[model samples]
Target: MSATFVDVEDVRQRLGSFGVWIAPMTLLTTPVATQRAQFARIESLGYGSLWSGEPPADSPMGGREAFAEHGVMLAATERIVVGTGVANITRRDPAAMHSGAATLAEAYPGRFILGIGGQTGDSPLSQLRAYLDGMDAAATQVLSETAYPRLLAALGPKTHDVAAQRTHGVHPFMQPVEHTANARRLLGPEPLLIPHQFLMLNEDAETARGAIRSVFGSDAGLPNGFYANNFRRLGFTDDDLLDGLSDRFIDAVLAWGGRDDIVSRSRAHLHAGADHVLLHPIAHDLTAAVDQLELLAPLLHN
Candidate 1:
């Protein structure tokens, strides 16, 4: 596979060192004006980037498209970069994905990063390679200049190798700092290593663990999901994954407790060789999530 034509330095310069990943589904369902205000508030809070996921077809916002949402977010904010924490490649062909990414890159310029993931067929690595090849070919046909910066949601070593060779970086989701260190070592020093860290502002250990348990449920023990498999690879035994994640597993993966604790966990990723850490604050209410972002802003910015 060939290297992406997008300028990696420009992407690094734009994304900065810290970002927030919010589903923004709540805001999307709200009135247009309110949604815009919410985005503006996040940007004002000093986050370098705002990351959102590609909603499923049955999403509450009437199947809101990721590329379209990226445009809306860019329009709503002044300086904050907006990106897909990952747009599912299985949902769209590579040509469509390339066009959507290129359109956002053209309109927002430095303010858009295209992160894509989700396995497509029998072999995910092979599918990803084909997808990248298709994107490169599509760029030649449609986009004469300005390739969009892309990040892959890679987890294991094989996928990390593919990301190192093809895309701008790897955006491993739901892994601990140990995985971040391993990814950095595998990808070497040049490629960006941006890992997502789940955050819970609650000081109560049981409460935070409960939230994580609800999120993972039976999947925590299953060997199928990416989180389970990655955790196992990182030396978490079946015992740790049983009963919706053990207390030990919760502390290892989540950035919970007081403000200081959250800050410490966030910094651990940086210390582990991550270029940037995307904090995924877990809260049902959008208002509460925004408040959490405000509270963590000073610590993260510093």
Candidate 2:
């Protein structure tokens, strides 16, 4: 199960040390021309990659299909690498996922990365292994020149083991710096380890805490047990998970306050052994998120 299909060096060379993960569905509601302009602006801001989570289409937020959105965003921008923070595997069959990823890789070449996760399933590790097997079979038919680089939405040790054995790397979302260090230890040094770091630009402490609560409050209820377990592993008590997350927990998971604070948090991940940190800035409006990115551009390592 060696990950011979992935070109890890090339992926690291392309993604660099920092990226932005804004909800792609946010742009779906806007005019197409405006969406293109915003993506272009992000590329100009010096972020190395653009990542998006795949929300359910029936959800109130109106999630677009990840591959379709990736195609649109990739076409809209010139150089910034575009990826799925994670595209859930349970939503579609493996053949469909493989074909879609292959198509994007063929069309976009090095600019696309497909990150897959199991949203709800029995034994996530077993399900992912089957999915990757299917993807390999599908790739032989659909891909002739190059295989697309992929990542697993892995957090725990078992999942991380599966990722290191089967895919290019692990994309651990909503994890703290300690988790980053632990994941790197499990993933070893060569595989790609791109962890997501939440950010809030508000200068006031309460305002930033409020922003954190607003964005991640629902995670405690997510069907997957990953978040709660990871928090406990980081020494967060049940009390910390309640009442809009304890102050210490919020501070650990989010980078808030001024620009320096956000930059410092992001740097902590890199120092903890992350190959790259995907910044998920918390803001009520898309424009505000872009503003945060603008402020962060100067501080990020190129």
Best by lDDT: 2
- Weakest ten-residue segment in model 1 by summed lDDT: 55-64
Record all residue pairs in model 1 with backbone atoms less than 3 Å apart, i.e. clashing. none
At residue 284, candidate 1 shows an lDDT of 80
Writing each residue's lDDT as its tens digit, candidate 1 over 238-286 gives 8888756678888888899999999999999999999888988888866
lDDT of 2 by residue, 1-302 (tens): 42226678988999888998976556566666776787888899988899887864344556667888778789999888999988878568877888788788878878988898855556767767888888777766655455777899988898899888888898998889999999999999998999999899888888887776766554442222778887787798877886557788888888998899999999999999999899988876667788889988987854
**What's each prediction's clash count?**
0, 0
CA shift of 172, model 1, Å: 0.9
Question: After superposing candidate 1, which stretches have Cα over 4 Å from the reference?
Answer: 1-4, 24-31, 55-63, 218-223
